[model samples]
Target: MKNIDVKSFGAVLLALTTSHCLAGEPADAGEGTVFRSLFGDTLERDYGITVSGLVDAGFSRNNNSSQRDRNSGQTNAPVAGLADENFELATMHLFIDKALKTNFVPRVTPLPGPAPSEASFGFTLEAAYGRNAQQARTYGWDMHLGINSPGDDNPDKARRDKQNFLAIPNFAGTAYLPYAGGFTVMAGVFGSGLGYEIPPNIRAARNPFASRSYAFMTESGAVSGVLLGKRLISNDSMLLGAELGVIQGQGNLRDNNDSKAVLGALRWRTPDMQTWIDYEFLVGDSQNDSTGDIQTPRGRLISRDGQFKQQHSLNGWHRFDQKWSIGGEMVYGHQEGDGKASTIDIVTGPGFDQAHWWGANMVLTYQQRKNLSLSVRAEHFDDPDGYVLFPSSTARGAFNAVTAGVRYDVNKYLTLRPELRYDWFDGQDSARPFGAGDARNQLTGTIEALVYF
Candidate 1:
């Protein structure tokens, strides 16, 4: 709700840049020696330090695609051209960890090696620091800091600014859970647990079907207060878990209002099957409103009188065998706003809810080997408010798409993926396409690479 002066904001950006540069140096030094230590059995005695990263560079040709040129150019149908491209950066990450043995802490009495079992505190100070290249280009630095608690088992836990698709226990130190286990309390900024694609914050590319074309839910942001509980029904087959939280509503950053949200989920898993259903309810000032008043640089922005939004999702995954798997996700959400009648045709009618939308995705994958895999995915989206595209329209549009791709494990530390996609639009006559002119069909190709250590 408050805006920082340009100078103060610039100072914060500078500090972040310096921090990222410093973090990258140490990890880069540790990368070379990590492999030697692991293979020589020295890792057991020494801390573990590893480095990994990826670089993906490739050429793509689009058919029936349109392009806009900044320089002098001639208009053409499905214009096509070729040139060297560096669409995405391949990264190499370095990690360093020190493992303090289980008995390092002293027990109440005293036992062997380090301390007594009962009194001993089994813990490890796992600190992670890294810098990314994208940060260098955009923010002048990519600095990260992470610390994990002792005996923490969930590796997929959420992280600050990191987005995750499934709702699971939080292992990342950033999560604001009151307690770690059984009737836990958590609060902080965490990813939305709906949607099939990886949370958008950490995504390497855009999610084709997200409501906002360039906005990934992961990057949507969060500021939350939560309470969670989990009950294990069976050793491995059933589990019931629930989470309730009040989100800050002002996107992912700090703000002064109590825009609240509640979420709950139930999960079941076996060797061959897994399924989950989640519900989310959001009530508060519209994302466009904060502090009961909408303030903008130019003047006071009007707040919609009865604006509210809600979303729901269901997801499941099944492993048919060691080599094949199938999964699907469905999500729907609606936004309603009340305001004075508007003469503008694009605006929802008088006191009308402006946006109603729903969509879903399904994917099937096959692992040909340890180093290779293939996947096919389909997605559909409908936006009645025309929120996804500019020139918000009164006529709703629907979009459907299909994508196929292959992932190759270039090595233990690197992976490369190449994909091709096609998209189609329903009600072509009712809405304009993404590019200029009247086109309804589109195609795209991409190659991505990932590296981890």
Candidate 2:
């Protein structure tokens, strides 16, 4: 796993970003963003507060949209927040951070370098609204779907986002101690650091295509826990870091059950910061039943159905030249004691003791020009029992996605992204998951405008 990838999301992210191919945007900030220069960098360099955000709006056309499905409010469907057929506001995002100062010598890469000569404290806050907030919602908040419901049939579920589901993906504080290497401790609700793509954000640095991968679609978006990160080894050519945390079960605002879980991550990168890899995992009973009553996505609390699971992944990226790069990720998950979910109730008995799924994808990018880049991604996901993607369908086997996209920098504070993608399934025939369950495959075309401020 160490020999394969660069990376995305999770613990070490409070640190600066490594130079990835999708990296030159205002989000990277070092190349310079509106907010970074708004106060002439004084906000970060003097007051220590940095602000950044964007407004994302787009239109999508799906080849599978039918009159019947459109009337029912389901189209190419729930693959992210992009499950709609016309013009829509995807999200309005805001990020504010007071960076912690570490005692290590700063490198030339990664922008907005904080004062690294001393040990200090800092905090981060993020708020997002629009269709994308649906997935960012916690199990016991924002949303209301539960385990025993037939399915999510809210009617309003697919068309647009209401004002009620606003999400704060991160509200955490950290302290950096200039000790052996460096010790950073953080607490509060933070974004999940386990995948190659950031949670629920189509604008994530790893997802230049503006569309998510199957590997990132259904993982928990946030966890109310504490994370500890440390730089173990730092040198001119290479660096290593580690993190550990304890938290409430996945997507819970408060205690949904009596048990908590443990998660840890390890990362290694080069000083040049062009190549890196990450490995991380979470182990615990994120469900109800043994510890307490089960709480559904809708905040409905009921008796447990024996839900215990594990989610793990390994991902990374590498730059081969000024204009070429590649990145890849492998994801695996296991669930035990989970009852089959249905409209009526959670089913338990024989033939439902455990479920497992795994998937992988590779991304290749070419900097066609200084202001325009092209990317192609190929991925496959398998879930025989539909554990993670339960609400999508019950069909099993291998699911695949192919995507090609273009990123044109209209300017420093704006980008235009146009993408085309195809998704299909093989194996089970009992259910159809796309085009509102009427098609085995779907093709979608989308173009978005991201205006940074």
Candidate 3:
């Protein structure tokens, strides 16, 4: 008999527990409740804390695979986020949330009335056995650009080399203020405010798609920072926020440089809350070194130093009645002085100091029934410096893809999505991104199941 790996086993157990907790069913009293009731002692255990989680798994096949055993390693999808072709566990997320009592005003009150404000604390512990988990682990605490570690030099690859499960991406504390018609302050590691797509399990309703767009595929993941937000207009029609952080992205255990990143955002919505728009901008330094698996984009291992990175993005969505809606995103990002060995020649070229990339995506969804919805997405991405794409080869170019899928609610606790996607490459060299220089276009089919508890 083969001995089982203990860590993998533990991850599986955690996943199951999370799924059971978030499955959309009523919480059971269970033996603990019975014991407490029998003793007539309610430990005040259920106070203000909430626990929830999800288990996401998928079965996918990539026609571009090089062999049955090895991946093609040339697709646009980031490493671990999506495999070339396989049945995999995408993510298992467990969330714990607690709201601080708002009525506990101090004996010496500064305000005339009760402090009707509350504070909240929440954290998500994520685990994965597949490629996506391998790509999303943040290393160190708030590390910056241009530092190197000995053993696993490639930050992104290091994840592939290390554990098969476990990631803690969201650890945050939020405070609500009653001043100026109420506002919020939050600090910790959280998702970036720049992108339309986010890591799964953050929202009550999961996005109806299996894969993500190029913008999400290549953009920053999370940030270690502090943020402030407040609604400005009546009916919550307008909101503003700002973020100050250690750097632009995640994965580093410590700050590698002295500089930091700043971000600002403005959001507007209709009085009916049917249509909304957000504009966000971020400026900061991005590390050229490999920090870890969590911060890298598309599994590209960056090895330069003191690279300046900036981003501008706009995102919005509109609801046309309750059955149909549309959303879109546009983003442009640039980086310079962040190249490695292969980019030296290019960076030294005349009038070339930076690499630029831009992309746009649109998503349309239709609700077919109470438990069913359909969605389609199309996007185009451009990369001129080959910075975020083909980090090894000089594959500066563009990529285009489209996806169509359906979301079916099997039950309150289970959801399934089946999708089809196609991608085409327009690199300088025959689009030789996949292995053996033979992959320029790809067709993939995938089905994903999500269990919430």
Candidate 4:
């Protein structure tokens, strides 16, 4: 496994170097753009287009987990275990953007599949038009239109078997209007400006964290709404901001329902440092069907059916310097629903009325140099329901994990990252009847290479 990992990393490094060297020299380039003339007029202008992208690939191995079998597939310990080797081409993106003037510009980013297991490797364009007289005054509108085709060959099964092309057409916009009292009003659908780190979907794109473990409370699509208010105090030394929004419901596909979601957040930053604190709250009737099935964009499943869940989270991050940082987040969720017999009366459950889950994550990182760094993250989850239908044997459970990795910058355009992850699971004795006991542990190591353009 170690030999394979080294060979794979070396190959990716070679490819990235070759591509970077080629990119430095354009074919038959002799001040090409500046010399071009159109209709006796110089075509050269200060404005230009910029394009960039990245490709990441690597191999990983698992230790205590079940081996790869042709029938049961690969199992990587539900909570934490090692199983097999894997590789991925993380992201391949092309961005075309132009700055028309000091205040106006247009941009578009089209990306294809980043990994081989993806359904289809085709471009999905996200285009936008914007105007920004200054950072304090800016407005932008964007639209997305694409067709995603399924890669699976099965054509008969209805739920997870068939393969088809899905069309996506979504519109969203945003405006940041600043006022005299260090305040601003922001409004948009699917717009940016909700929090510090990017959401899970946008971060991973193709393979987002969708299982019950992450994102305790799930929403069907992007949050679409209007946010009001802004930073009460603003300066290089201190900052505070608050926002509220009324968004579309979680499972409403048509965007025509009267049900809605209300969200609020408060953020604070210390002066003269990269340290911040954020508190967020979400409440609403996020469920649609009364049946025990929850509808998601990918499909429908029965888990926390007909349950109303509320989530509260607090997060903090501190950057000691350019070379080191630490961050952590704590999240709590509570669900109210009809219990087994009670849900039977409402035709929704066989559920737990007062189900709840909570977890926390901590991360530490050190940048040894411009081209190398090391990071470690530890996380825990406590889910009373083992993602099963009501009255299952798995009553309550807890999972804990620690991941450590080192990243090396092969060059300006390429980077290699190797990581090791360990996980531990604790649950009822009857929860798992297989060879594994109530407590299980596993390990995984992955080496990834990224090439940026």
- Judged by TM-score, which candidate is best? 2
Q: In order, what lDDT does every prediction score? A: 0.38, 0.66, 0.56, 0.43
Candidate 2, residues 1-453, lDDT tens digits: the string is 101111321112212233332555434323335465455788767878878776665677888886555444336564554655565556668889887666331111121223255678888878876556656665554444342122223525444322223677778887877666567877888776777876533344777876788888655668778888777677676777778888886777667657788877878787777898888788776454432444554222133543567889888989999999999899998876533442112432333556689999999999988889999999999987655665445567778999999998755555788999998888665667777666778888998767665
Residue lDDT tens for model 3, 1-453: 012354674466455445435554344422122233354443336554455556676667766665632333224243223453454556666665554333211100011224455444433333333335444545564222122232124544433332234455556675666676555565676656566776763323325688777677565555667766655554343323333344434443345444567766666666565776777777777643443432333223344445677787888888998799998889898776533453232233323356778999899999999789999988887876666543433456887888999998665556778999887778875556543456777777888777665
lDDT-superior candidate, 3 or 4: 3
Least lDDT summed over 10 consecutive residues: which range in candidate 2? 1-10
Off by over 4 Å in 4: 1-17, 22-52, 64-67, 70-74, 77-85, 89-171, 180-221, 250-258, 290-294, 297-307, 340-352, 387-395, 432-439
Candidate numbers, best lDDT first, in rank order: 2, 3, 4, 1
The residue-by-residue lDDT of candidate 1 on 1-453, one tens digit each, is 011243653354344334425545342222233344346546534444322222222334344433432111111112111111222222223323332222111100001232212311111111112111211110001111112221012222321222111111111122112133323333443333544443221223222221122112211223334434333243344444454555545232333223454554554444222443333334444433333432211111234343565665556667777898777777666555554452111333234435557777777888899778888877776765555332212235776777788877554334566777676677635564523345566566666544333
**On residues 1-453, what C-alpha lDDT tens digit does candidate 4 reach at each position?**
112354675675676566545657442311222223222223233334333344434455556434432112123324211122454322233333332211100011111111122111111222221100000111121111121212212212211221122211123332333234323333343322322233222222211111122333221234455545455565556666666777654323333323566777777777553787877766665443434333332112233344455667777788888988887778776656555543422223445455567788777888798667787877887776553212111335776778787777665655566777776667654454111333366566776555554
Query: Candidate 2: what lDDT?
Result: 0.66
Residue 419's C-alpha lDDT in candidate 4?
A: 77
Show the colliding residue pairs in model 4.
62-82, 62-83, 63-82, 81-442, 237-271, 340-350
Query: Which regions of candidate 1 are displaced past 4 Å?
Result: 1-61, 64-86, 90-181, 200-224, 227-229, 235-237, 256-258, 271-285, 290-306, 341-352, 388-395, 428-430
* lDDT for model 3: 0.56
Off by over 4 Å in 3: 1-46, 69-81, 99-130, 142-163, 201-206, 235-249, 288-306, 338-352, 390-394, 435-437
Stretches of candidate 2 above 4 Å error? 1-45, 71-74, 103-117, 139-164, 200-204, 290-294, 297-306, 338-351
C-alpha-based local distance difference test score of model 1: 0.38
Candidate 4 has what TM-score?
0.64
